[model samples]
Target: MQVKKCSLIALAISAAVSQMAVASQQSEAKGFVEGSKLKVLNRNMYMNRDFKHGQRNGTKSYGEEWAHGLITTYSSGFTQGTVGFGVDAFGLVGIKLDSGDGRNGVGTGLLEINDAGEAKDDQALAGAAAKLQISNTVLKYGNQMVSLPVLAISDSRLLPESVTGGLVTSNEIEGLTLNAGHFTALSNRNQSSRDSAGMKSLDLAGGTYKFSKDLIGSAYWAETEDYFRKYYGNLNYSMPLSDTQAFIVDFNMYDTKSDGLGLSRAWDGEKLDNQIYSLAAAFKTGAHTFTLSHQRVTGDGGYVYGPDGNSTMYTAHSMQVSDFNQENEKSWAARYDLNMAAFGVPGLTFMTRYIKGTDFNTTLSSNGKEWERDVEAKYVLQDGPAKDLSFRVRWGTRRTADIATGNMEDLRVFVEYPLNIL
Candidate 1:
């Protein structure tokens, strides 16, 4: 049955491509063929996670792995007409370079594991989408990656998650954009097969309106079939204090409630009702930006979303290790960012943040407390032979007071080179 489903998807994509080719010949597709773009990104990723205390399940005390990936993307422009047509596709390939006995687990999320508790050596995943445009409104169908306030694709590992669905977007009014979609299944970052069991169906709609030059407002809602419903709202404002100084404020909120059978009720054997909110303020002076933020989660459950392990929270402290989203949790963070352009070095940047959370509802301790420190350094080549090449290093440490064996240190090194094929 799975093979049949895969074959059907492949056939559908092939049919779409064939129809696009035929349309290009009939319509003067100069824009479609000439304006197309292709690019391939070569990525090398290495990750290490060291447990400060003894590991759980007697598996291993540390996890480490290295992988290389090639991601190729092709985007074609619409044909010239009142109603245009186009197509887009992406191909991903991941090769495991090193996954020793202690590192070949699902925790890394870089490779898939088999029944024998061994990670796959290599894997490939691909997807394609067909699109139609009429004026400022566009429609897309088939497999694709989507990013919205309530639903976002995860790209934290060798490959990003992709979903099979149809979406409609429009920007008919100036400074306003609207989006709506229905997705049936998703292929996670580590798996090559699309699975509908995780989230049977997802329906989402949202809009963003730019109130002014420095202020924007957004609202979104999403419903997962037989699971839950989620609503999100955001507000952003910025003001220039002087020629070299500015201040910005951002506020975000989320409301979640169970629906239908409430599948997530398995977590606590009760209906899920949660509210999460965050507020952040930033002050920028020349090359330095300082930020302070606060976030809180209330009610019986924590923030709920897909199971992709990537956060869609619009907060300051959602780092690589923890989201600080425990039930009845309140967290605060202070962050600093430095731009190297001010110090005569371009395309280099550094960021560090510390977050602390308390007032949890865990079994270990009712007033559990945890803290995390995250640091990142990145550089990108601007010009010359290696233009657009980028390198990044990320490190994070989490310490917990009430939870046993929960302290961990994470480090990752990522390098990428993108080549334009067209």
Candidate 2:
């Protein structure tokens, strides 16, 4: 980060000023034009371990990745002060110049490519986003990652996860935010394209989602040509018991029958209803914060809602939970964090947590169990030219059988720095 900060400043002055000024002028004339709002960002990541398919799970002792991402944004200025019409566009590109097939456990950062049913290496994935709106409500359409607990955009790897479709969000109300969308496709980082083999459209239908003080709700229905009619809804609430503590509760339910034209299921291959309920409490004060969250899965199969196959929703460890490989499970998490600045150490922090799931009834076993533990720390340059630059180092270990097949015992060290340009 020290080197990067120095280099960026050296590269920013007199070096590209003329080129940038010309581009800025062109953008002002052509609103929503491509490559207008350009940014240079890089995430340098390191991992100590890789995946394990049991005996084949672990990999090289250590691995590293340096990814440079270029992003460009576009938008029109508000029209004459009153009600305005504007459009926004986003372009993202990720380039990976390191790692080989042997060291490719989990830190490769780049998705795989297929050649004659074989594997090939790739260097990048490109994604774009566009949105139009008036007032405080803007409707975004195209391919970009959307973030929400009920409909989150994933950032589990070198590049952020993305999807295809339209999303609308409104924040005109004080202390209230409303969200809704209908997606027809998803662009996972690893996949080659949006039209890959495993991707499914599921007779896509629109849905409405709203969130407000102490209240959260969503209603959505999707009809896949080959499967059942999937309807999903969720409700969540949180209130502060004091100045430093928050109590949270969430309920999620989904119903799936048949599409009336197809048979069989993908992923879990089970035809049934799925539901999950979660309760959590979080406390934050001074330099330290602690959180406790518990989740329960009921009905048959796992759960489904929105465009993700990730765990239930609204949890940090959902990326580790999936499928019927381990069923009817009860899981909980305990996390602790610290801010070094409170102790006169600026830009330094620590985080650690443990998550475990057990109690199962699946084809693999009538009884199964699994657990995961993670620890992480970070530091940022608090002063000087790199005042806002940050670096994060994370380490995680998972011990499971017939459950969670990726990242045996993983450690990731990554960094991100943002620059403000007007």
Candidate 3:
């Protein structure tokens, strides 16, 4: 790693502080039993992936799957004391709804597959974490979901991923938050057993600071044993022009380098050094939002993540079907979002985005190119029987000149309902 990459972590730790008053959270703590709560979510999802190239080079022609998932969680509030303690637990169950022998390929992340290439009928996972709190800082240990810029758990599939680890979070200062954690094992979304991903160890530290109501900044660093070290930084600012109009600018960047073990484990037996960054601007007026962004990747390899989480990449162009993260790649994107409530149709929203990448280096061609287009619609019940229930549909089409990726169309449908049963 470059010496300059250390600046990100330093900047986060040395951020300037303002004269904002921070209240003592421990002083208002409630008893554990009094603050305990339980909740459950029912999720039904169906996904289809159609390869336009169709089984070329021995790949699957298409992939499709449907599954129903039930997730239950319980969280106990801190006890009333100088030092408080609590416990959190989660249970997940995924049942295969519709998946044929040939349709349940690796592309469908909905269910587990056996050695005979058949999808499992059902899978279950359970985990728990114990937490202690003092002042405005908390320490948690055991299995849990971690969400940070460098290391995060992926929850895009039927069930959310989890890691066995210890995490410390501090909010002692107003408008500033700090986090640190070390994880030893990971459980994937489709598996029932723990440590399915077989991660050796991971260490992460990061912090986010709100400079003001309109501006915020974050920095993070992470290291995966035998893999690589990653450093990330972000700045986001919102400029309000009036009550109904505003402009936003967001920037994100990452620097990555491989370790000795990583070099040995590389598929092509090559070292890895990469830098990726993105800048985005958005304008919002009334119920509509327009966004434009540019992203670039440079160095010896593309952005690499996973065994950490699929959602670890926080770049602007990491879209539904493609990340546009090939080595020496430059991508541009345009997006629009609409809220139907402004048109007398409450609880409905729509989004569409297009991204194009060029000047990428690939083994097949030095000047590789790709593009993706995505559209999504979602609606939630406004009131009455299904008040919080939601339905969402997403479609994405991707075309690429890279030999590794075939042209494809992807579709996903989701129905979700949450129940509070404390």
Candidate 4:
């Protein structure tokens, strides 16, 4: 396989500057006690999965579990000064409402499991970060959740993951936001102990720029010790045809290869040298939207991401149950979305999508194939006592010839309510 280097990363950064003036955020800081906020969220979730070809647990062919989560967060405004200082803190807790050794284990990241395979009844963790701001730049240190293109923390499960690190974000340049970070520890979504994933050092640098109201671009570079280094780029553009209609296009690409210590320390022991890209286009008019996308992977091995975070991959086909990522593979997807607000239902929505992948390289079969279908519906109360309460349901079916673990069907239900207190 031939790999194309990401030589344009530097060019993208240099071109991000604009003449637009940006005000200093630190200069207008309010007193810490006057500008603080605290919020809490309650989430209840249930999931069930049926295995058709293989069992996740030693003897069970199906897995089912229910759990409840409580998340509380606090953010304090910077103190009034030339260099403002503040703190951010969070507490997360999860309790098992229903589960057993045979019904739940490694599949669902809702609870912790002991060495005997018995799921723990509860888990909790708390963390905080100290921050300082100067001009339009902020520097933070401690444990926190990060949201960068190359090193994002996964929040799809019951609880979001976290990392211990130091980060610097600069908005000094108008229309451009720059980020740099060094992380040394990781905490999984299910585990309460920090560094549970046993991750080493991870370093990242990136920036995003808004050229106009409808055009944006980003580029990033990341390195994980004893793992792989990755270069990523993204471009998004939107064109308005009318007041209620628009066309949008998004392009994402990544180039990855072995870093120091190379594949010698990789979990799968596969050589790391791959390139992947995805392109998606969508059209919307009124309450309905339609989308189509294509994704391709090439090189010595499939694309890989993280001891950093599982949700770091931002490809178009990164679906609900399957990533559609495999060596020498190509995938295509079609999707439809509908907003019920146009039909007089303000907080209801529906979505469905299908993806097909082919030409995957595997030991069992070189030209393997796989497919997935997913459907989701969600609604939120718009008024009255249960105003901000929401309910969501998702169903997915995945089948493969020789590309994935096995055939599976999954169903998940979530109910959530949030409260604000400051």
Structural similarity to truth (TM-score) of each candidate:
0.90, 0.73, 0.93, 0.93
Candidate 1's residue-wise lDDT over 1-422, tens digit each? 23433443344344434454343332554578786999999999998888764564455767788999999999898888756799989999999999986666735678877668787898888999998865566678988888777778888888888888887776656798877777788888888887623868777778899999999999988777787888989999999999989999999998888888888752346788988889999999999999999999998877765632254666555677888877788999999999999899999999999999999766677887999999999999999999999999999999996665568898989999999999
**Per-residue alpha-carbon lDDT of model 2 for 1-422, expressed as tens digits?**
23432343333333323343332322333333332454545554444455564344343444444445544444444332222334554555655555554554344434354454222434455655565434445556677666654445556665555677666665444444555555566556545466332335433322334456677776655554444566666676777677656666656555555455435342356665555555556666767788787776666665544334222255334533232223366777788888889899988999888887778555555566767787888898977887678888777777766454533676666777766453
Candidate 4 per-residue C-alpha lDDT over 1-422 given as tens digits, one digit per residue, 9 for 90 to 100: 00111222223223322311335677688878777999999989998888775645545667888999998999999998767899999999999999975788747667888778888889999999998877777778898899888888888778889899878787767799988777888899889988987778888888999999999999999888878889999999999999999999999998888887774222246767888999999999999999999999987678776677878898899888888778888999999999999999999999999999999887767887999999999999999988899999999999986844557888999999998888
Model 1 regions lying over 4 Å from their true place: 1-30, 307-309, 403-405
TM-score of model 2 relative to the true fold? 0.73
Overall lDDT per candidate, in order of appearance: 0.80, 0.54, 0.84, 0.83
Give the poorly placed runs of model 3, Cα more than 4 Å off.
Answer: 1-22, 55-57, 263-268
Worst 10 residues of 3 by lDDT: 12-21
lDDT tens per residue, model 3, 71-188? 9999998998777899999999999999995788647677888778888889899999999877777778998988888887888888999889878777777898988777888898
Rank candidates, TM-score, best first.
3, 4, 1, 2
Pairs with backbone N, CA or C atoms under 3 Å apart (clashes), candidate 1: none
Q: Which is the better candidate, 2 or 4, if ranked by lDDT?
A: 4
lDDT for position 158 in model 2 = 56
Model 4 segments more than 4 A misplaced: 1-22, 263-268
The per-prediction tally of clashing pairs is 0, 7, 0, 0
